[model samples]
Target: MAEYIMAEKNNRMIPEEDKIFALNARAKKMSEEVGRDKVINATIGSLLDDDGKLVMLLSVVKALKGLEPLDFAEYAPIGGTTDFKKAVKKAAFGKHRSSSFVEVVATPGGTGALRNIVANYSKIGDRVLTSDWFWGPYKTITGELYRELCLYPMFDENNRFNKKGFSEELNKLAADQESVLILLNTPSHNPTGYSLDGDDWNGISEAVKEASKKARITLFVDAAYIDFAGDEEEYRTFLPKLEDMPSNVLPVIGYSFSKTFTLYGMRCGAMIAMAPSEEIAAEFKLVNEFSARGTWSNSTRSGQVLVSKVYEDEDLLESVNKERAGYREMLIKRGKAFSNSVIEAGLPLVPFDSGFFSCIPLKDPAAVSKRLEEKGIFVVPLAKGIRVSVASISEEICRKLPGMIAEVIE
Candidate 1:
């Protein structure tokens, strides 16, 4: 018998352990970064009130109040409310599909839909493709499941979509894996507030088709901000992927009422999967239903009921839509102001056209964020650039962005 001796080598993590720790640490750091407070957040995604409070979409809340009658005491079905699912489909993919062909499931939020979409399409170690410009949560949600978040370049130096870079990335992923996933966020992007142009959508579609020819790839579109993008018809008409509803190339959309109707804390959203055939759609429905059961056990039943009720009421929806359009245009004003100041200051501009987020390329993202915070401004720092949440920022706050960056530079 030999006595065991304590050794430092035993404490060292194996390769798998090291990789897990890296992921854990990255997620932890991100959670902390997004939780910071702000006197004037030039880099926020949520809308703010005139008093600098987070704007609660009162219309949605009022709509939700009617659902109190539904009772939380009752356990909702795994598939969620039928009315809610129908509403989601009407709002998301429209009536393009054969009525029986369309299917949807309630999810905790758009993010829940995202997880469900990914789970239905992929397995561990599968390559998930998204634009280099993307929501931070993609890494947390996809990576934790052991999938790789592959990034294709989104915009060029002028902040326009880079088709070649996108094509290359898709081709590479298709060649390397049996299946690949591509996530497209529009009519606007988070943290950048940009949407794809007409030409860009065409390029992306061809790229998706090209990649699909090589390997089985799913296109997941996050149309979370479709309500704020000014023109729904333009988006609906152009994103041929949504209208055509391809079969070999599956397209799943994550629709969130959280932003459009301003129901943030309520957490209401749905996932709609468009498969080539009803059989495949049914298969996805089963996975999504199971995901709903296992994940959150159905989204807020009351919230779903409330939104459905609102959708059915044309008079109510029209008023809400008009008011929402007003709020959305203000965001455009605020963002343009920020862009103008950045231009005047001779700072680099990150093209933002669609959603609430935009970024400026900086030498050090963390340093720039700190300096902005010191000036009573707060923002998000990303690998490629500094993300600005234009919807939450006021014209006054937006005007100060360039000066804040100048101070950081000095």
Candidate 2:
């Protein structure tokens, strides 16, 4: 007889260890053995100060500490507290709020929002589309939902957003499926740090608008790193473009407080829908709320209260933004340092604007990452490249890494 199995058959093959977490664990163990100064662990995607301490916004911390027991201990409504929904919309849209009917549902994080989208928008065995360089969890989310993840090349020969490839894939998928869910992570895309400009957004809008003629289109914008991308208001200009699309083309924005509010462990975010009509927006809220109840019963109340408290008070909001802007400047400085070093070393890097991460495309990324590990340096190895977390490292490390990676490649 075969050995008894515990998990459902479909779940049995899931990898026990997450690649990033496993690498991070190894890096930490090494740090314990030697010292932190000797190690360069860029495996995690969290903001860290120069001394390698996790950076938390003082304003956010104060607000959290001030919350009364009832505010945090009591259960929030299934969808989210009313104030949270309002605050999340404000946080996500800023001054570029959409003109369409809108709805919001609280999710554990951007991960949960993506999961809900895949669960509701696409049928099992259907394909979900995104750029070639995307957050790895996208594949995980789609796979767990029994859906396929497809990709279009992110850049063309000119080293720009590949609008043609995106259109081709969108048209192809729309033709085959009843509905297509396209995930676009912009204003600081992971691993590559590429943000879509107005023109790129226009191209996407046109492509989806055209593709919607063939099938229903759900345009999911994952703005997980938006706050850290650049000037907050400037990075949000593309948001208005997400509005006024054909009724068949639905725009969904995944907003995460993890990065925006430095509440990573709080597991809080929201899925926002911009529908052409009130009926569609209501339908979105109902369906996503049902999904939320079935999966994670409710998001953390404390996190919701933190957002509400901050947003409701203008003085506190300004303080939080000011603190966050300072960190954003630090990230920009680090990104510039790395980009300059890469150019000086003649290292081939994927096009990066402003974001927490950047990628160096190459063959055998895993092997190269392993070699770097031996040198007390750790970075994530993707299918096509090695990802370096600029947010987690010091400027000195940022400046030195390109040369070290170049030497390793040679």
Candidate 3:
């Protein structure tokens, strides 16, 4: 054994491993023991074909392959190239672009953007607000920065966005903290696949604006799954609402190419900040770049260049969106099939609307998940339920999965 030297922050750290990967590894081994078709592996959120292979977009791959060697060998600027930054902002805003001053900074992935936001936006020990059913990594990110995560019940009894609950929590958090950062991952939320519609966004905006009067507010929108959620333009309809926000309220978007461009390994994404005034936007850019320099130094150059090239070409952009539409439709179909099957099987689930994963509520999620695993079905067990990855399996499997889970739970 070697002596361990650590900072005060590092001293309290215990080994924290993601259970999803462990479950996936076990699923992979079982798949080998019994043929691949015999096992239901719904452990990961990544898009996978019926044959359990990774799905990549042809247009995205072509753009990457066509890149010059220099692109791969060089380092991107801390804030990314101008063209790439503009492309990301355009993608985030759609045609209804925000009139506020906006600044974009390249990060390794959406994860990096989340990390920066948690580290910089809130003071140490402040609670970052989100829904109860959220991506597990949000807690990990906040905890690492010495910030606590506070969650409101995600839905009401009627299975709609719990605007009332959210408002209550927002006010409570505002009372406790001088600065509040609200992170909403929507249009296909992780673990539950729950999405907020236009009305939901309006309520959220109103709540944030109201809270800003009592406490400085920073709203972070994590749109990593936006492309796969539904019609691109329709999902972005609420983005323009951020324009002309109160000076104390800052709206920042964390955009990722991992799912949109099928470039997960390339690790390219952007953090976009919108402010009522140009001075605030400039300050946002400067601090973001400074953070980038201190952390990863720069994002991948070729990844940034490829995204810029694809969006810049009208034909290529059209082709990419068309191809994505096919997959998005498939995901929607799979989601519907699973939800229908769950309803028919008399199994209860959290509300779902266009997303990669769904949650089936259970009293003992881990016990239920293990029982399902014994029958060759693997899923992630969350605090409130078992998370099924509709994005990873076939529609047929999705239809069959709920029945399998119901048998074990019931």
Question: Which candidate number would show the highest lDDT if scored against the true structure?
Answer: 2
Runs in model 1 deviating more than 4 A are: 1-38, 93-100, 243-246
Ranking by lDDT: 2, 3, 1
Off by over 4 Å in 3: 1-16
lDDT for each candidate structure:
0.73, 0.92, 0.88
What TM-score, over all chains together, does every model reach?
0.86, 0.98, 0.96
Per-residue C-alpha lDDT of model 3 across residues 210-280, encoded as one tens digit per residue: 88889999989899999999888888877877774778999998999999888899999999998878998
Clashes of each: 11, 0, 0
Error of 2 at 287 (Å): 0.3
Q: Give the root-mean-square deviation of each candidate in angstroms.
A: 6.3, 1.7, 2.0
lDDT of 2 by residue, 1-410 (tens): 13336656452246668889999999999999999888999877999999889999999999999999998789999899999999998999999857899899999998889999999999998999999998988887888888888899999999999999999999999999999999999888998999999899889999999999999999999999999988889998887888859988889999999999999999999999999889999999899999999999899999999899899999999999999999999999999899889989998889999889999998999999999999889999999999999999998899999999999888
**Of models 1 and 2, which has the larger TM-score?**
2
| Pairwise lDDT winner, candidates 1 and 3 | 3
- Highest TM-score, which number? 2
Question: If candidate 1 were superposed on the true structure by all CA atoms, what would the RMSD be?
Answer: 6.3
